[model samples]
Target chain A: MEIKHEKIKTNLQKILPAKASGDKWDLHLYIAGQNPKAVTAFNNLKLICEEHLKGKYHIEVIDLLKNPQIAHDDHILAVPTLVRKLPLPERNIIGDLSNKERVLAGLGLVDHSELKLV
Target chain B: MKKKERPSHRNILPKSPTSIQGLDEITGGGLPKGRPTLICGGAGCGKTLFAMEFLVRGATLYNEPGVFISFEETEKELTANVASLGFDLDNLVEHKKIWLEHIHVERGEIEQSGEYDLEGLFIRIHLAIESVGAKRVVLDTIESLFAVLPNQLILRTELRRLFQWLKRKGVTTIVTAERGEGAFTRQGLEEYVSDCVILLDHRVNDQSSIRRLRIVKYRGSTHGTNEYPFLIDEDGFSVLPVTSLGLNYSSSHERISTGIPRLDTMLSGKGYFRSSTMLVSGTAGTGKTSIASQFAEAACKRGERVLFFTFEESPSQLMRNMLSIGIDLQPWVKKGLLQFHATRPTLYGLENHLTTSIKLINKFEPNIVIVDTINGFMVGENQTEVKTMLLRLVDFLKMKQLTAFFTSLTSETENLSIPDVDISSLIDTWLLVRDLEIGGERNRGLYVLKSRGMAHSNQIREFRLTNHGIELLDVYVGSEGVLTGSARLSQETKDDAEQLLRQQEIGTKQFGLERKRDAMEAQIVVLRSEFQAEEAEALKVITIEKARNERFTQDKIKMGKSRRGDVSIKTTGTKKKKYI
Candidate 1:
């Protein structure tokens, strides 16, 4: 089983480079201070990215209070703003990321109808 | 008496005067000091302008620095908008007298995910206030938050707390909000700021849009409740409160000329009282403008500035017409002593006209002001509004001790009644110029209808527009009533002819009496001569008869003496002598 998993990972890496140069999922979570909403959004994004993207995804956490000027770069107006920067079309989902279906759909990671079956 | 006995509540509340034209008087002073005043209005109703003006005026006029926090518009947009009004907001900001902040809250860009308050906004305001040491703070349209934030509960609590914080900050603040459908303000901002709420409405009446302002609520204060009409022009906002000025203007005993000598004589030989309002009401072609121009010319000739507001004629047209009448107003215009402001009554709303007139009056500072045909102002306004505006204007003029003349065009059909505006009571002197159609000719007749504190003429004089200006001639009053125009000349000629005929008859009667006295004197002289001749003839005849009787008497005496000698003895000689 291990030899087969290793062979599948090598095949995935070989095909992923042909599709895109960077990681499949590049997410940026914007938070101001240690807000509970920001913390919850960070944990939810981590869990979803690990389950769906595994090693193909990357996450960047931005503390607005520490680096407030960076918030203007992505036009972050509210705390706990999640920006999807990797795909050809960038998207933004702002909230505590409590709704799994909506977060997954907003991130374009999973189809909306498929979440009901899960 | 009752008013005096009542306690004056106006003195109890310490007020910060806004210094805005007509607003201070309407608000009884201004917005309550150090309290938030919510100003709500629809789009383009002058909410932002009013707020900015308040801040600008407060900073400039009252020497108080202000902070402006704009939620909808950028600082550059605000600066450009108010720059037209001659308010150099950028200069003021650079001078540290005013601080402007643009709090941009885009609805789609900002998302409230978790529990949050408007601490960011509060801190920014605090920094701005501290930077300028502001006494007045303005939050323009706080309702923009309702669009940006999804959590209304947090917003409401935060807004309430913000107001309380502003109150505790001890700064006189103004919060502007957008008017909502069937609500005084959108997002129910009126509930949060309970100190004062002023609502501005832009309504279209008779195809003309007029902005009106009303104080919906003022806590712990008595304010004007009437809906005041305000105007937004090059010079910010000016609210005209109708009849807000009571009868408290100081009266002047000095007299000013009406520009016509005969007309002056008609007004008790002195003219209208100084600082008094004079209404000249006349029908069409009754020389109302002529008289108004004459008064303006007279004021200008006195080296006093004159402001002529003409609604019917242009400045050049008026100047040319007056020149034709020998008034020579062009000189005054060239000398800068007379100013002619000609505009159509429909150019703006009634309130706009009032504000424009007031601004012009202030800028020009004329000693005498003449509004040619005030009836022109009645074209787009109701009767009550016209009367109120006139009253307010007249009161303002009287307060400033400026002589004012208002001309009104009365319809020919309504000759018996006064002008349509019914400003007779507000005017101190009312001159009625009417068209007197008599003997197949129409002539202008002028009479003083009323003079409040002077004994004016009761006789109607013929109003004539002559080459040397207005000339008032006495109308011929005979058994056929008043006769004017050619009829007066004919009547005068007939009277002169009859007087001459009567004088000729008296001369003939005196000549006949003189001739009869001369003939009687001559007859008396002839009678005296004839009597004297008769007396002479009688004397001669008596002497001759006496001589003849003496001769016969001598013979008879001789005979009687002989007989007497003979009879002497016989007794009858005495009888013979007696018979002789």
Candidate 2:
């Protein structure tokens, strides 16, 4: 098998942190075997991040099968557990990631206009 | 023609003194002065006893000789029945004070006829009344007339005429009629004896048979309209009007402890007011009897008399059981402070039980009374009668100013007694015992549902019966979820663990906060020192630049002076002085 290490490095390079000035952010999309809904959720979040953040974001899609221990350590009782491991303040959100707006807001992407009113 | 108010006269009628035990109170005095009071009821309702009692008491106690006419039982059988009551029927017969005549009417005695009269009955009754000079007369059971009559209309007419004749003769009489479903009497005797009418009923409430007497109406006489509980025992009949004993009769007002502080706090000040009616209802084995017995024991210890009526357990058995729990009733019995009357509900009837209870109450004058488990009173009765009996019983107790405790068994939480003679409503306090399942264990619990004119704890208090009598645990707050019998204590222990956990959480949070604050303070100190150093360096650089600028200015001035040549070689060219 002609496994090209360059190809993997190129992929890793695209995921590297672009700049340090903006809010540092990294998100993980957890999915099980290949299901249509899971695949849709991944595409939806990917498109949303590209359009909103452009070059200021990094995301990793973990299949869980490749790292089962990670799920156990997090006490993940269900499938598809999203974890944000870095960025000054870290957070986690769990689900199929069906609602993009909600996922973005949960990750502090949307401005808290309502809170300012209060 | 006022010309002669021919021998103005008045009817000197003999009053029917309402010989019923407690019925006189309800019916202001008694029945009409001279009238036939119809007594009708279903079979086994103490109807025969009511009629017989009126005649016997009238002849013996009041010295008003009477007559008894029975068409159902023989005179000898009637005599034997009242013998246990200490009534000398034979002596009354010899003295002609009471004439007992049995009219035999066989089913084959009827003859085909379109019209007939009760002339024979009228003749027999007149002769019997004349024979004894009887002021009171009782014709037991009018159904026998129907059994022998061939025409119904004629029987009705003759019955009406017979009542009128009795009224004319001025004899106070009691005529018993058989009760039919939805009908006052099988022969409709109420239509004729409209002046004074009463209905008797015997039923099983919660498995025990109870008898009740109701005064339908008494013209020109105020009577108790409510159905009163009556007991027919070896001593005849006694009625219980529990409500009549209210506040006018003075009570001790001395509070007695329930041996439980929390429960005492629930009661007025510390315990129930003297002469209060307390009702305890619960599922099977929920400690109703235990609570009642505790109250009884408390009364006996205070040197107050207590009477305990048990229909299910024998007196000895009750004493033995109570002894195991540290309640020594034997001492009270020896001192005559406590008396136990244990008998089967079916021994006589509700009327008998009522009579026996009244006799003991009147004779012993107990300060407190207890009826253990009232379910037995509902055995043979329908719901209505059971209610009436209980109301009368409670009223009587209240009137006597006696503290009474009654325990009832409810099958389900919704199995509430109806509002007929509702004992719960008549009582001043009500306690409910129930079984609760929590944390995989079944536990018995008790709570006060109602307490009138007093403050009471609304919490469910867990309790147990041990060698110490009754041990009441703390209230259940559900902090550690639900708790069952075995783990209720464990839940408390769990609650203690929670407190420790909370304390540890506080300690960890405090340590984290202190570390964060220390780091912040260190960063602030470092930043302050760096700022001071930078300020000193900037000040040195500005001083050096200022010195360099001053030297440049001095050189520029010198250059300008040289260009002008104002003092060029003044010492060598003094002679060549020129304005060049």
TM-score of chain B of 2: 0.62
RMSD vs true structure, all candidates: 12.2, 51.8
Fraction of native Cα contacts reproduced by each candidate: 0.11, 0.00
Per-residue lDDT of B561 in model 2: 85
The 10-residue segment with the lowest total lDDT in model 1 chain B: B109-118
Evaluated with DockQ, which candidate comes out highest? 1
Please provide, for model 2 over B324-395, each residue's C-alpha lDDT reduced to its tens digit, 9 standing for 90 to 100. 888778888989999988888767555555566767888889989899867666645466556655666666
State the lDDT of candidate 1 residue by residue for B512-572, as single tens digits.
Answer: 9999999999999999999999999999999999999779757765786777665432334
Report the lDDT tens digits of candidate 1 across residue range A1-118: 0112244346456546655555576677776666566668777877788788876765677766665546434555445677788874776676777777768877777775786687
- Positional deviation of A71 in candidate 2, in angstroms? 99
